[model samples]
Target: MKQAATASLLAFTAGFVDTAGFIALFGLFTAHVTGNFVLIGASLADFHPGILGKLLALPVFILAVAFARIYVLGREKRGHDGAGGLLVAELVFLSAFLAAGVAAAPFTDADAPLTILTGQLAVVAMAVQNAASRTVFAKLSPTTVMTGNVTQIVIDAVDLLGGASAGAEIKARLKKMAPPVVTFALGAMAGALGYVALGFWCIAAPITSVVLIFFLRRGAASA
Candidate 1:
């Protein structure tokens, strides 16, 4: 139950940050690599001035994942939970992202170094989350992206409605998958609305959630 709650909160954070990045950074998707690829192609064809930042995001994301994997492996070697360490790293990166965005307010210059730097920080934080979800929280449903989750939800719904013999199992699957999807949508909505109202300060929502997750894990470990 605790794991599920934590995963849901992480999903919410991903959605929140991704949406905020999209709006604040001019269509950049920190959490969605596939979308970034499409945007890159479009930018290349249209000669978009921000193409450099978009092009850089993919490699930065990959490097972040590599760093996270090494960090997690080292922690496991020393007999500790790597997930907590990864979460802390993510929080730090996100804080840096928010700080950079604030310092670079009115992102009118797409080619500005600060604009690219802030975008890179957001992508790096989300890449750590992607790696952590796959390694540290492998047992939990993915919290960064929604494509697979939605597919599973549809399949499970069909099986349940089709009167599968494993009704309880299907129900359990639904319970595990539904909350994150719903919360992610809600988070995206909140992210958009919050950005309109609070600008970069909107990040406080996800930052608060990550802090809660860290403390919750600590409490669980202590207990």
Candidate 2:
């Protein structure tokens, strides 16, 4: 149950940041790097002016993930929970992203230096999250990307629905996969709406969620 709650919260945060970034930055995805790649290609082909941010996002994300791996490895060497450290790093980046974004508000130019920096920070924050999910939270279901989750959910549903003899394993898998997907959708909606209503300050939603998770993890560890 704890794992599920953490995963769902992280999924919600990813969806929230991704949607908020997308709407605020003229369709740049903060959490979904693959989407940014497609956008980069499209921008290149069409000579789009906003391509710089998308292009920079990829490398910045890679750098963030690499940094996270190094940080985790270092922490592990010292006999510590690397995941917790990674979460802290993510929070720092996210806070920076939020600050930069708010400071650069009324973004009319996507290629502007401040706009690109804000987008890059957001990408880095999500990249840290992606790295942590793969390394620190490897035991849990992925919370950021939904492609594999959706595929598994569909397969599990088919097995359960096709036969009354379907075992508890199928049900367990569904239970594990369903919440993140649902919560991600909800977060996306909330992010879009929040961005429309509150501009860059909408990031406070995810920041608060992460802070909560950090404290929850700390409490769990201490207990």
Candidate 3:
């Protein structure tokens, strides 16, 4: 139960940050970094100005994931839980993202130095989250991206509808995948609305959500 809840929160954070950053930074995808490739192509074709930030996102994301893996491996080697530390690192980067975004709000140029800095902070934070999902939280459904989760959920649903023999497994997969998808959609909507209503200050909600997840994971670990 706790794992599910934590995963949901993490999904929400990713959705919220990605959407908010996209809107604020001219379509920069902090969580779904690959999406930036498409945006970069579009920029090149259209001669847009935000290409630099989009160009930098991929390498920054790769480096962040590498840092996360090293941190997790070091912790595990010393007999410490890596997830908690990764969560803390994510929170710190997220807080920095929020601070940078708030300070650099009302952005007029996506390729501006401060704008790129803010976007990279968010990318790093989400990269840590992606690494955590693939590492210490491998048992949990992916929280950053929803394409696979939605695909699995649909497959399971179709099987259940067709009266497949693996009903139990289908149902289990649905239960595991549904919450993150739903929460991610909700977070995306909320993020769009929040950014429109409050600008970058709206990021505080996701920051708070991460704090809750940190405690939730700690409590679950002790339990």
Candidate 4:
């Protein structure tokens, strides 16, 4: 139950941040960084002012992932749950993203320096999440990206319907995979709506969710 709750919360955060950034930062994908590659290519054929931010997201994500891994590894070596510390790190970056975004709001130019900085801050926060998902939270279903989760869910459903797998096993898989996917979708919608209503202040929702996760999973030692 704890694992499911945490996974759902993280997925919600990822979806919320990704959508809000996309709407506000001119198609910038803060969580699904690879999606920016498509935007970058499109921008080349057509002209988009935010192309620079898209171009920079991949490298920034890479660096943040490396940092997250190292930080988690160091904590594991000391016999601590690295995820707690990483959660704090993510919260700090998210807070920074919110502050930068609010200050940089009314983004008239996507190529402007502040716009790029704000987008990168979001990228870093999601990168930390991506890395932590692979490290400390590896036991949890992925929270940021839903492609693989949805694929697996479909496969499992088909197998269950065909009786190709044991009923209990298929049900178990569905239970594990469904919540995050659903929550992610809901979060994406909420994010788009929140951005439309509150602009960058919408980020406060995800920040609060992260705080809840941190407390909910406190001292679990394993996720």
Best by lDDT: 4
Per-candidate TM vs. native?
Answer: 0.96, 0.95, 0.97, 0.96
- Ten residues in a row with the worst lDDT in model 1? 43-52
Over the stretch 78-152, how does candidate 4's per-residue lDDT look in tens digits? Answer: 888788888999999999999998987899999999999999999999999999899988999999999999999
Report lDDT (CA) for all predictions.
0.89, 0.88, 0.92, 0.93
Candidate 1 Cα deviation (angstroms), residue 3: 1.3
Model 4: residues with Cα > 4 Å off, grouped in runs: 219-223
Query: How does residue 13 of candidate 3 score in lDDT?
Result: 94
* Alpha-carbon deviation at 126 in model 2, angstroms: 0.1
lDDT of 3 by residue, 1-223 (tens): 9989988999999999999999999999999999988887786678777788888999999999999999989988999889878888998998998888888788998778999999999999999999999999999999999999999988889889999999998898899999999999989999999999999889998999989987897787688
Cα lDDT for residue 44, model 4? 74
At residue 17, candidate 3 shows an lDDT of 95
Best by TM-score: 3
Candidate 2 lDDT over 1-223, as tens digits, reads 7788888889999999999999899789889977977887786678666688887888888988998999999988998879877888889888998899899898999899998989888898999999999999997889889899999998888888898476698898889889989888889999999999998899999998888888778778888
Which candidate would rank higher by lDDT, 1 or 4?
A: 4
TM-score of candidate 4 relative to the true fold: 0.96
lDDT, residue 119, model 2: 89
Candidate 3 global lDDT: 0.92
